[model samples]
Target: MDTQHDIALTRALAEVPGPLPVSGVIHVAVPHASRFTVVGNHLAQHAELSLTAIGIGVYIQSLPAGSQVGIKALAARFAEGETTIAAALRELETHDYLHRTRERLANGRMVTRTVFCNQPGALLRGGAVAPVTVASVPRPVVTPVVPAPVVAPEPTPVPEEGPPPVRLPSRIAPKPPRRPLPQPREPTPELHRAASALLADLRRHAPELVLSEGDVEELVPGAAAWLERGAHPDAVRHALTTELPQPPKYPAKIVRHRLTVLLPPPLPGAQELTAAPRTPVTPFQTCEGCDRAFRSPAPGHCRDCRAQYWEAA
Candidate 1:
């Protein structure tokens, strides 16, 4: 619709052969132009400065010392959304209003540190201005422009309406990451000694329940498992060392089966475990070659004896 102001604007913009003189003054504060903090109005509200960016900046600056807030919290506080906030924050980062830095705490945890700036295009490191950082200003991230609805005088031909088409992304499920394969374990002499010692301890209580080398190896793990579950060694000895049934033909087999089937449960509490006087155990296995005691087993030889035997071999 044609209006008086529209007609005047049209006439003013029209190209003519001869020039019609027109001039105007834009009043600006000289003090604002001179001061570092007092930015020129156009500079203050540059194309990069969205309403969301300005609001985010204000919110950051207004936060109290030792206070921390997250992007989701900010979205909830402003009654906006995560996507909108993220886009605004991206804009802020590109324009150098802020940059996110990864910081490590004394406790060895990683945290994201947002450094805010009243002025754009400044170098920073974890909320502190870094004078050492050379200035190389980054370009701003462009926000998407949405076209306005066009109203027409006459009705246009509309396409036949149907249900919206299903997207490819919505149907497919993402696959989980594959795990790495397990590595084989190596055996040590102390592990062997432990199995032999456990069988030796069991023989002290029940002489008939004899275990072969292979049986000792298998039963050692079960005893170790019971110990790990907080059962006392004495309790395990009592539980497995039961009365012989008649002549006890296969006592060893019966004992091994009982040990396997009836593994001890974890100790109920600290007091139950501490009720009996518990002594710190220091394992001593004598070297067969040297007739000398050693803290750890070394194929029936002390470290010195073993080294000598290997060198001699």
Candidate 2:
């Protein structure tokens, strides 16, 4: 048999007919003459042997040496479930078409070795069984890894009480400390002012939705996040307070949910974090007592009106 011709034949069969989108040697089995044998014949024609099992065996056989093969890897190749791939592997093992034997290395690591013998007596040339190739056990290489050179620390200076020490070159200085990671910048003065005004308005309009100092802290970050996304403060406030009933319960919880869930898409420069107003303010909640605009997320009267009403009482 002409071995050179066989190589040429294999290449010719695997050649792409049109433009090759990908340019890498694929580790795949082509229409080799020896691939067609009694076992392959039976597998291809027999309904008992599922096409999946045959394909699985072919894929495994096509893998290059030392390539990792797992149920997950196999399933990914065919876009099938891991369980399905595992079952197909079992079928291949049952038919003596493939198998895996484990070998533990000197480093206490166990590795699975895949062996292929699907066409038991079939070779690529004729329908002759191909010889099974078993890889020799991998001996662990214990090559000593040379560690990096250590920098000697500076020697501590001794007091003059001792006899004059032998004059030698000065010792090395200690390494400088590593710089700390940068923390997020505190909210800008403008940002703080805007956020506080929003908080006050929310509280004034929704008197039932009172916000504590701690609640304000929790709510500010979410609103800032929306602002960073380029949403106007007014939009964020409306989205947060629009659904709340007058004197709504659990103001903190309702506001947190709204801030997190109802975030608007960032406008072009909203992410730039400027203090200047990008959008005109549109008031949503107004004070019940004085009919003034609501400033905080909580339901309530404006500070001036609420204070005056208390004074009158």
Each model's backbone clash number: 0, 28
lDDT of 2 by residue, 1-313 (tens): 6999899877875674655447676444344322222234655554665778887766655554455556766667678899888888788777766667776656555666666664544533356433434334345422222111111122223346778779888798989764331111456666656665676578665566678888886567666666666678777677866757665768887877777667666565656766777785655568888788866666778889888999999
lDDT of candidate 1 over 1-313, digit per residue (tens): 5698888665655644355457763232222221122222433467767888766755554453334445666777887888888887787677776567676667555666665555443323433332322223344423222111111122223457799976676656778553321111333455446545866677678887776767776566656665566566687677778776766687566656666667655557867767777786767889898889888733477889989988999
Work out candidate 1's RMSD over C-alphas: 29.1
Residue 89 displacement (Å), model 2 = 0.4
Off by over 4 Å in 2: 1-39, 121-313
TM-score of each: 0.27, 0.27
**lDDT score at residue 206, model 1, on the 0-100 scale:** 83
Poorly placed runs, candidate 1 (over 4 Å):
1-44, 122-313
Model 2: lDDT equals 0.62
| RMSD per model, one decimal | 29.1, 27.2
lDDT of each: 0.58, 0.62
